[model samples]
Target: MVASPPARFSVPAVTQPRINEANRKSVGPLSMPPRLLLGPGPSNAHPAVLQALSLRQVGHLDPAFLAMMTEVQELLRYAWQTDNRITIPVSGTGSAAMEATIANVIEPGEVMLVGSMGYFGNRLEDMADRYRADVRTIKKPWGEVFSLEELRSALEEHRPKVMALVHAETSTGACQPLEGVGDLCREYNCLLIADTVTSLGGVPLFVDEWGIDLAYSCSQKGLSCPPGASPFTMSDRAFEKLSQRPGKVPNWYLDMSLVGKYWGAERTYHHTAPINMNYAIREALRLIAEEGLENRWQRHQANAELLWEGLEDLGLVLHVQKQYRLPTLTTVRVPAGVDAKAVTSQLLNDYNIEIGNGLGELGGKVWRIGLMGFNSRPENVILLLAALDRVLAAAGYRK
Candidate 1:
């Protein structure tokens, strides 16, 4: 059929309101300020990872991309020290991965016990509640972690289908000891879910050995990649729970049963994967493999210790006890009569360094400093301390 003379416009096409140019401006090319990210997350992406991010993309299902996908999975298994076959990066942030775990395992009205040790634990409770899980919580002060005995008592009383704990409580800089907590869950015949957002690559995490059934983490923080594309995994037990679930997962985008096919042997397309993010994460995980987990963990620990010592020497108090402190993140008590945000601002505006103020109940009470992945280094630690010393002094903090 011959096309009718090009469709006629209402008035004359040229006279019609030209696509609104009001919102368009001659903006300069994107340029963000140089920032030394020493905050709780989005810690400076490793230079190598950033380089990978700039690499050309491949179709999500292409052989080249699929091969890289497998490599990423293997490296993630190494980083988390788990052999869970369903392990893969979710296509969103840490929060999405966090929700994905809850959405899949806890059928509506099933009890979920959340050990609310800090900010993220509360987040887990919220996500579980939204998923219609019967969310129960046991609380600790912001900077303290739950003892294994406390966890046992909570589990015994709640008898939940799942128990969620933060492996590293970012807001408080407290590392929750998972050694016996997992065993406690197993005793109660409950699946253990762990939030490893701040712990995965920097802290000592043994998912398989620890008896954790489900876990999730971010691309930032310890992984040293940009945010987006979070790591998620489920033990066979957790996957079985998902397989036997009564209905489709409540939230479709994060439902791993469908998402898993794309990452699993089926290679079924669920969504267009974030191609460059996969590249970036591969490079970040590659760095972990090259440096070796032991060496990387040691480097993080050493730098954290250096920072702790330097801060102590400068008369700033660390919020968490040394034994329980996270190598990746630290919470420093705000000095008396000192403005927390001001100190943070001075660090960023004057020194080109960024540190976070606390979140939730800890807000304005502590400063969150991070030594994560590529940003965890002796030089960065020393530079931060020196800058902090000056900033504190300028803020009228006395030694």
Candidate 2:
């Protein structure tokens, strides 16, 4: 009544939840069961690469990291067998590099001729279309490589600005023979972009000799490294086209003009690069260098031959012709009455082996077996053949 002093308020003490071990969620440390990767990609990374990946992380722009980046570029050139100054690893997986090659060099409305041999070739056509290019395709049945004459005819007829092809079709296990096609591209004044995703380290790819204007490959397939930091190289002709584009590159992150500066002397920042992946790839390339490319290619070929012979013994027919078949990836026609997916599942679940089933049109018709990178070994071939034999036999498969 007499204007009493304002009472001070205080926060009431509230009891917190009790910390009990019984109430806490139980989670264990990371541990994955051992697996033999015989699929199209990500054949178990080499021990050296795994160790490198676990090494200390560094800033993308760190001096040591930059030096390593330069080394990685040089090593990639060796792996790709090119002297292209614009060679570098794209920030994402193989598809990112594929997109970069298309988004930068192929301007909207420009005619692009694609050789559709298999699933990957179709992918190239799709990427080019996304760039708004006038895409024209010369398709061969899946598992068949395009002949040089066919390529020449398409190039002459369409006279497209770019001719894209997949060096190794993972879906069909066919290897496109570059051969005189590069000269054909030169004659037609067309740029050649090769998707070497399945062939980069395991197959013979002479970019300069073959006159490939641009190429992209994944790290996981034949590089014996985890997926990410894909290899991308562009020749002077391709770079010139990229530079002369009237409009800005449709993909900001994959724009080679800006990405090149980051990998070049300018060392500009474009994005937060996958530093550990670069380290892993560098070590993988180092392993490649230690084992010469010819030796590595021969190892893949030899192991593939073993697998082929084993499959033959099992009475399984190969999908691709022997001449054009990719040594890194083998597609086996699923025998009549035998489930392809079931075979792969049994191999993974029972044998701890992982093989791939077909993609797109070939799904359930074939099984894609990859003898790539660290997984390309005589013992692996033997294990896969034995495991496959068991699985197919149990599935009631017969010659």
Residue-wise lDDT of candidate 1 within 1-399, one digit each (tens)?
965566563345465545566644655589999999999999999889999999998899999999999999999999999999999999999999999999999999999999998889989988999988999999999888888889888888989999999999998999999997778888999999999999989999999999999999999999999999999999999999999997999988988889999999989999999999999999999999999999998999999999999999999899998999999999999999899999999999998999999899999999999999989989998899899988888889898
Identify the candidate with maximal TM-score: 1
lDDT of 2 by residue, 116-135 (tens): 98888888998888889999
RMSD to true structure for each model, in Å: 3.0, 5.3
Which residue pairs does candidate 2 place in steric collision?
none
After superposition, candidate 2 runs with Cα above 4 Å error: 1-24
Clashing pairs in 1: none
In candidate 2, residue 95 scores what lDDT? 97
Task: Please give each candidate's TM-score.
Answer: 0.95, 0.94
Return the top candidate by lDDT: 1
Worst 10 residues of 2 by lDDT: 4-13
